[model samples]
Target: MHDSQVFFELLSENTSKEVWADSAYRSEENEWMLKAGGYRNRPLNKRAQQSNRRKSRIRARVEPVFGSMENEMGGLFIRMIGRARAKTKIGLMNLVYHLKRCASLWKSRQ
Candidate 1:
């Protein structure tokens, strides 16, 4: 099945009320679902360069963090067996990423 089909299944799990995704996730069903669930949908605009550019400006800040996690930090695919272990692993990884980011900034400032 397409990822979008199952994407909403995890919607309730999110702590935030906003949902951001690319054009691929844009559909009438998804839009209806988001509305019904009271989520602020941040759908990427495929047309209109001006608006898309504005949207990309926000995405710019987010893409790198995921890229760094995937390439430098061994990716987001957790291999752990259970939810608790996976959460712990992800929490530690997130902590490490922040620590690494701090170190980078510290060195740059020195």
Candidate 2:
């Protein structure tokens, strides 16, 4: 399937009833799909903009980690062939991140 089809497929597989996504995922078809799947729409559109401010505050804390991954870890690109290998690569990257963070904290304490 295409990337767009995969997105909907993921939506269908999700356990949560409330979907929090970007405005780019907004559309009549997606909305209908979400509704049919018993999901609460929380796309970042104008009508829902106020709710996103609080979500954005929470998301801000997580954003810097991605920034560090890009700038420090040379990006989160897993150039592996399959999902299993990709998962392992990401797992190793996360392990490296934790080790680095631990070392930094230890040095700060010293």
Candidate 3:
């Protein structure tokens, strides 16, 4: 079981109900407030089922995003310097790619 201090500190202040990752956060006090997202010993509910399905659908979209990043904009392994600079550079690249994708879709309709 993991401590709540690190997770709680990292989370945004607006977050009330903690997303139950696994058995790590399982406890009597957190049982009602926490929602488990995975298929563990924990009981299943309709909301958990829907959340799992939604995560699968979202994972499908991530493939194309990565593919575009690799094939179109070169992989994230490009000769980047430090972590801070690399993050900024990659963020700008993604922005440009998304704009181009929108433009191409718009032009295709014409």
TM-score of each: 0.52, 0.48, 0.46
Which parts of model 1 are misplaced by more than 4 Å?
1-47
Candidate with the larger lDDT of 2 and 3: 2
Candidate 2 — which residues are off by over 4 angstroms? 1-53
Instruction: Return whichever of 1 and 3 wins on TM-score.
Output: 1
TM-score: model 1 vs. ground truth: 0.52
| Model 3 collision count | 0
Which clashing pairs does model 3 show? Answer: none
Give the alpha carbon lDDT tens digit for every residue of 7-98 in model 1.
88777688988787777898899889888989875544567567879878988988878888899889999998999999998898788888
Top-lDDT candidate index: 1
Whose lDDT is higher: candidate 1's or candidate 2's? 1
- Predicted model with the maximum TM-score: 1
Which segments of candidate 3 are over 4 A away from where they belong? 1-52
Worst 10 residues of 2 by lDDT: 39-48
